[model samples]
Target: MPTTTQLVISGQSKPGVMAQVASVLASAGVNIKAFSAPEVTGTGKLRLLVADLEGARAALRGAKIRFAEETALVLSLENKPGALNEVADLLTQARINIKCGYCTPSREGKRAIVVLTVSNTEKALSVLRDQSLDEF
Candidate 1:
């Protein structure tokens, strides 16, 4: 299985927080591939997969943004019923907890990419890689 580093940013939620972060990355010529931002109770969290990890890190550091980088499993699964459930079950059976996850919208006759942050990245990757999913 292949794994990629994902940046997780958490801070007090406020207007323009995401904009500022993106601006910093963009100024550094970093391209964001996948992103998710969810805010609750004045706190916000952002997760992103960047085309240039080093550049993004530098930009974040230059902007004084605190973030954590972790290994994430990216799976390309068939766009069909029970696809996600199968992955979830595989993780559950291994006692691996999913810390955070999101999937791209599935299109007809196409596969969907699911990005998962698991409690045990190596184990999850091993398990998923062993499966017959479209790709891991």
Candidate 2:
């Protein structure tokens, strides 16, 4: 399995917060590959997968933004019904709990790219590899 770095930014849920963060990253020439942002009450957190990790880190630090980075597994799965269910089933059987997950479809719409943060990443990776799954 392959892993990618995800940057999580924590801030208030007010308007323009995400835009500000995006602007900062863009100014540093960092491109975001995928992202998830959900708000609860007045607080929000943005999880981002970027093309340039170092640049993102530098930009965030220079801007004094509150953020953290984590390694997340990236899975490429067929874009069809039950695709996510199949992967979730495998993780459940392996006793791996998914902490966070997000996905996007490929340009041609034939495959889906899933990013997951699991309680046991190494074990999950081992299980997926052993099952011979196609990156899902």
Candidate 3:
């Protein structure tokens, strides 16, 4: 697990918007580690965790895309029932607040990459240490 930057982009919820963002990053050789795009009322809020933060930023800037950045905690958890529950319980016990989260699993579904923005990231990481809920 590690701390990384997450880019949040808000844009019109229409066809080709996703393609436009993905293409810019792809052209810059930035790999999307985890991504979520949920649209509401014709607007989409996209969150992305990419391998190359600087490259992603550059690409988005070159494309004139407006985005905001945040510090996020990244975790690798087992891909199975109750996996998230364990983490949530641990955090709850530690009194750490989870602001928002998203996850993606491996191709074979063996493990998941969880991205979280928490109320106290430092405490969250420390509290998570030595917990079985996290694989890394």
Candidate 4:
């Protein structure tokens, strides 16, 4: 049940905006472990899991980039179909709602690290831990 802080950035969608944001993080020496940015209509949002949280915050502040922060659960699941479905079912049974989530292949390619922002952090952690989903 490892928890990490995710930076959320929202603004109008424009060419080079993501590049600018990336530059800011890079300049601040914040390593981006994962990210999800999607554009809809004329706006977009960027969610980033950065290694250096404080550095990322400072950089965003210095760049006048308004952002929000949220706690995210990081889980490593087997790289197979229905892996996420199983986790989702567990959370659903616990009456927890998933706000957003994304997955990326692990370095070894044998597993996937799923980052999830759920409605109930404590409950989600407890449920996952109780189910031995944290073995990874």
On lDDT, the leading prediction is 4
TM-scores, each model vs. reference? 0.91, 0.95, 0.85, 0.96
* Residue pairs in candidate 2 whose N, alpha carbon or C atoms collide under 3 angstroms: none
- lDDT of each model, Cα atoms only? 0.87, 0.90, 0.87, 0.92
* Alpha carbon lDDT at 100, candidate 4: 92
The model with the greater TM-score, 1 or 4, is: 4
Q: Which of 2 and 3 is the better model by lDDT?
A: 2
Residue 70, candidate 2: Cα error in Å is: 1.2
Segments in model 1 whose C-alpha atoms lie over 4 Å from true places: 106-109
TM-score of 2: 0.95
Model 2 bad stretches (over 4 Å): 134-136
TM-score pick, better of 2 and 4:
4
Compared with the true structure, what per-residue lDDT tens digits does model 2 show for residues 1-136?
6988899988888988889999999999999889999657677779999899999999999999989888899999999999889889999999999999989999999999999999998898888888888454
Clashes of 1: 0
**In candidate 4, which residue pairs clash?**
none
Candidate 4 regions with alpha-carbon error over 4 angstroms = none
What is the TM-score (0 to 1) of candidate 3?
Answer: 0.85
Question: Candidate 1 at residue 4, lDDT?
Answer: 91
